[model samples]
Target: MRSPTLARRERHDLCDLALVLGEDAPTLCGEWTAKELVAHLLVREHSPLGALGIAVETFARLTDRAMARLGRRDFAVLVEQLREPGLTPYALWPVEVLGNTLEYLVHHEDLRRAQTDWQPRENTPADDDAIWTAIRIGGRALVRPAGVPVRIRRADTGKEVTLRGGAEPVTIIGSPTEVTLFLFGRRQLHDVTFEGPTEKVAALRRAALGF
Candidate 1:
């Protein structure tokens, strides 16, 4: 039977890459090094206290403390911890697929794209389809905060999402991965084309596009 664990596989590969890149390598996640990024992943998955900090402003300090503490641990050990199965609430099947597929994929690219010699990975069609599904399910919220009429189109498959409640929407066209990155507020780094009214497109480009 075919496996239903593609996201888990991606997470494993990301963890392995983190271990290889060492602790001080730059990542697309602001000033976070690979170590910080790995710490974030560990806290995100393993600690409810840390995870709460992600959504609750009041918990921000606790989250930072948790990450800092975790970041001090040996790097390879942390990566191994990330590879451990069923260690967090997010480890369940549908949740793993829904929550982590895009999370890990985006963060994986965050590491790669931050490198000067980076190139986009050749994702399988299955991977694209999975990301597209994520965009269709959760992308609207990411775009809605920008308060603009925006449409996202996948160049490879012609799939599109219209995220506006008004006319004269801005349409962004790219591969599924690129569109996902754009929606996630990585617009400056994503390779995409915008087609719409010049003013609207320009505004959309300048507007903060993600959650």
Candidate 2:
């Protein structure tokens, strides 16, 4: 779950992402402008709490509009809108708070990858729990085919988890942020140190997304 403080911090981090995108700058998500990112977030903030399909449709409409008229100045306004209390639930996830945390941290990294000084500082324990849950939910299996085993360790908490079976054992060690990105198809394996058999990692990389 997200603490109130962490939720607020993530909101701010997302707002900063929009602010830095400049008036017409494009984002890493397709051709979405930073303003479009803000618009999408705002729409998500206001989306229905029930019915996932309904939420998806609503988000698509909002994204379409945002893409047509996104601008830096508009993004600035959206940032201010986010600063207000109770703008929406502000809870990052619908199923589990940990899921939300993982989403925020990973997306924050996505935005930061494009900026020189956009790093968002995360509270260690929350991020740790989020990463652990993300892996257990079968996120690690996303890179490879079924039946690949993966051993992951959280550097901050020194907690080690192993997802085993189906081919070979693949080992990965690093911060939660690093592991999350790797599972989500963002960061490269080179940024992460891999041990165990090469075939294991290769097979794991070819597996489908578990969760």
Candidate 3:
């Protein structure tokens, strides 16, 4: 299956999980309820103003205002809206596959891992491959902000990426999905092994790491 199809399936699974967990359930996204997360997703994919808000500081306030309004609506209603196909401008296609695959995957984990007893989801080989591809394409940029050299190694495939060049280097080892989650600033929640000087590792951990 293609990345977009996988992402779409993940979106549906997220809605289903949101229903099962209830709208008010906590998520890794600080202070955001499941309903709020759904609203963000909706705004991101369907609202041009909201999408612009993501990059342009001038539009951020507007996006936040939109999200606040959307959050007030019924939770199930919001989920249903997400389940429907997105607006034509934002429909899943060429870029959607690459852009949304990691997005939906990470957000899905955000909701699941926020729970006390949650375990890592069992992903298929295809899911693993897709996520690895995402990492190859975008992961370097995500970690570049850390200002320290870093290496990410996939325990399963031995695939690796040196994200930056610096005097001090840190290595993070995990499955592709776990590495993806870590790169997305979910380090505390993601189970991965870190090998490096204590100070360097601490710096890497403290540095903002994400899109």
Ordering by lDDT: 3, 1, 2
- Any runs in candidate 2 off by more than 4 Å, and if so which? 1-3, 23-26, 48-73, 83-96, 116-147, 156-158, 163-167, 188-191, 206-211
For all candidates in order, the CA lDDT equals 0.82, 0.57, 0.83
Give the alpha carbon lDDT tens digit for every residue of 87-172 in model 3.
65446476667778888888998899888889877788888888888887778888876777898888888877777766658988
Over the stretch 110-181, how does candidate 1's per-residue lDDT look in tens digits?
A: 888887888777788988888888887878888766667888899987878887757888898999889889
Lowest summed lDDT over 10 consecutive residues: which window, candidate 2? 46-55
Using all chains and alpha carbons, the TM-scores for the candidates as numbered come to 0.93, 0.67, 0.91
Model 2: lDDT equals 0.57
lDDT by residue for model 2 (1-211), tens: 6345544566577667657566355555556556655555555455443223324665455445543443334556776775533544544335334435555555556566655544434556855675577666655446454466777777666677776644456777777667767676654322466677877667656654422
Clashing residue pairs for model 3:
none
Which candidate gets the maximum lDDT versus the true structure? Answer: 3
| CA lDDT for candidate 1 | 0.82
Model 1 bad stretches (over 4 Å): 1-4, 188-190
- Residue 60 in model 2: lDDT: 59
Q: Give the best candidate by TM-score.
A: 1
Query: Model 3: which ten-residue window has the lowest total lDDT?
Result: 84-93
